[model samples]
Target: MTTGSATLSAATRRSVLLLSFATFASMAAQRICDAMLPELSRTFSVSLAQAAQVVSVFAVVYGLAQLFYGPLGDRRSKFGIVTFATLSCCAGSLMSAFAVSLDMLVLARVMVALGAAAIIPLSMAWIGDTVAYELRQETLARVGLGTTLGIVCGQLVGGLLSDTLGWRWAFGLMTLLFGVVGSLLFIDRRRQQAERLPTTNTEPVVRPGFVAQALIIITGPWSRIVLGVAFVEGAAGFGVLAIWASHLHQALGLSLSAAGAIVALFGLGGMLYMVVARQLIRRLGEQGLTLLGGSLMGLSALVLGFTPHWLLSLPACLLAGFGFFMFHNTMQTNATQMAPKARGTGVSLFASALFMGQSVGVLLAAGLVDRIGSGAVIALGGGVLVSIGIFFARALRRREELMRLQ
Candidate 1:
């Protein structure tokens, strides 16, 4: 558990950068639909609630598809699977751009989600294979620059493209990004294969059947805790975030682009964390970081819920972004170590739980927003997040104590 900067080797840094680009593409595609809800509703002549199906459906499929990718990543080459998945994402984004009907768009998004489900978790698994556990969180935060910027750009790009060129252009842009990243990864894979040499020092991967691996991970106490927490975190955090654009547009009377810009500040907060991640980790440690992140998120939610003017949302969004990554990166680090022997499967299941939680949260929020209003829904989510943060901090402290004794 050393605290100094963990210098990445040249090859590892290159691979991480490539993977980060792919992650950026995937995340951008994921959030593009958020800013398009109003346009989609108008274009399809559907209610706002119906338009939200675009996000929810993608999340549901994304969560389910993780199960398949997990075992595949464990058994096959993670980078190879990611390369193929990136290509598939290119196809999906292209399909989305040309979708003629709501159903077609939903179907296209499903494809996008299916492909995207593999990228981040598999990348994390690959990192776990190469990086030590003590330095994994710091590595993740550094590599996460792509993810944080993608989140920022996703909201901004989605809003800007949807406002200026139309929602189709957003997907079109994603299509181009996916194509370029996928091609680069494919070439990198070939080069790696050519250079790879067999070695006896490396242990052969003993991959169990899919069902057995799933059962093994699900039955483990630590895995179960991590998965459960991730599920709830997704439900509580992303569920409310999913509706930010719509809330700002409808409730605050802001333009779609304006709403997106405000929400995009969240990513800036995450970027702030990335810049000072090592310092924060050194100063706060896991438990302290968890508490601080949760508090910030709760404060942000309350501000968003109660603020009389829309102008105040900027700082709120920033706080939410910073807090979210602080809390989430910790969970992600734990996920990488949940089952080191089957790291891919473990991380995939962790992601699966998270996205599944998002789907459930969105569904529930959709039902509740109309009744209690978006502010109330957001406030409730914030409260839950605070509770989650506290619980996890205590849990991490106990785990650390147990490890010290061991």
Candidate 2:
């Protein structure tokens, strides 16, 4: 149980690689609807908010389902659960492709959410069980390259397919993606079992039921702060993000494909952060990351919201993406270390708070879009995120001092 990647086994590395791909597909499925929101609205003859149910409902189900997965991953094989979940997503994606009505599509999306719910957090917990804290952030960033890329790819593909082939084609792509990734993971699992490798490690379980484990996580003051910040991060960051493409499409008069491409830069920026994350983590420290990441994203978001010059969007979106990952990567590191005794429960609880906030944010933002307009809403989200950064930075300081006293 070395904590450093330098001593990490080859089998563990391979497992992490496969888990990364699974995460990519899971996240891509979640965001595939971003560019398709307008097209779905037009196709179904519904309002923007109604069309957004595809994203919001998925978040709702995705968040709540984490409760089931926390204990499950802790007890069983996390990788095994992830493999099954990835395969399950194919069924849902196929259903989404063939969805005959809006309700049907929402239901189909719920199916997808049920499966996707197990991927990212459990993968992180699995990593937490393996990688030591010294290099965990960098390793997670490497794995998160897939997640961040999925953000861009999902939007890019959704917009591109919706514009060219049709919206249905987007789901078709996800079906193919899930099937391929799941099969690969299944093969890897079999190989690991056959070889009797020790790469697939699990944490030593504490004697508690899921409810008690969850209570242990939620009752900690530091855990409460991480969960709280995560909730706001979900709402203000990812939740309000559902509208960016629509805003560019509607207000800026860009095509959905074009708008999604620009928004894809946000993920691209995130990828950039992932690429350089190790360096930044060494340089800035977590507090600096939180404060600066939030400021950069907030200012960049304001530019995207207010600037009539669409060209400015190129840099604004890129910087915004970079800044977001800076903060987000820091958050991920803290989450993994939050509850060592019940790492699975702690990380899953963090994920639950995040997407639940996303659910609430999407619902609230979508409603306000009609009244205050998308720009105002987006800018408002940016401002809130700045405050979040500041609050979390101070909290980090307080936590460090408390650790010293202890």
Candidate 3:
């Protein structure tokens, strides 16, 4: 509820930095298949939507696994759980590199998703515990920068590696990245135990069961609002973006690698937003950010979807990324505060809502792409996101009055 940054130790700062890297790797693994979807389709002699099980299925497994990780984080050591989880991804990535069939690849991704499910949400929960509300948004932004950059690099790596060295090489890179980051995390945990350094987390003395904690969070009106918005955001925003590279490849006759490189600009735009997040947070406030951010993204999506010129797409994707993150970061800040008493469970529930939406969005968008065309599906997603933004902004405007009444 207040600033406790003064109590933040140097080791914790190091931990945050390490966690940032972990988040980067986690996010990178998620999007690493985006640009490779087309390549996988060709390799396995399947349809685009079928090849997309790599992304959609991973999301399903990832979202569901959060239910397990949420309560485990509350009862055990978050950092320790994260360390083990991170290491576990290495095995999955390695398996993916050797996958002989589409189904095998999907199974490998499930293994990776099972590990990666904990990385981002628990990292946020850990920050909520250690960093007070006053500093939470800024700290979360630091972690977010890693996340955004991962998006950039993931698209690039997936595209470039799949095109040149072979699609398996992308997973090879993940195997290495996860191995290294996970090891660093393990070492940090060991150091903390060795020196008996204090961390901010203390297990709740009278903590309820996971079901009760979840009920407490889901029962709150504002918490429900935040979760609902997250679901829609995942569906309309992140889920549909998965197809942008494929759309460009098929629609514009661009190489899959080139299309991916262009789409990677979206993440670069998010990195730019992170650089200026403090200014935006202070100037626009949450309501202004949501309204304006959604509008910008909607317009940009319309441009990116419709523009025939590949040159125009660069800026379109960039602006879309910037605006989407502006909206998303605000949602993240609110989620962190939604049920601070059960921060891990609350954040995981929020994540579940999000990735579940992602799974639905991918299936729907992919299914619709063949009928209406990818561009139309994309434009529709953009429109839905705009409506979500407007509704959320209005809800944010009334948040204070609503909270007081509650």
Candidate 2 vs. true structure, TM-score: 0.96
Candidate 3 stretches greater than 4 Å from native: 6-9, 194-204, 401-406
- Top model by lDDT, which number? 3
Tell how far residue 280 is off in model 3, in angstroms.
1.3
Candidate 2 lDDT by residue in tens digits, 175-204: 999999999999998987787655323446
lDDT of each: 0.85, 0.89, 0.90
RMSD of each: 2.6, 1.9, 1.7
- TM-score-wise, the better of 1 and 2 is 2
Candidate 3 at residue 93, lDDT? 99
Q: Which 10 residues in a row give candidate 3 its minimum summed lDDT?
A: 197-206
Displacement of the residue 16 alpha carbon in candidate 2, Å: 1.5
TM-score of each: 0.95, 0.96, 0.96
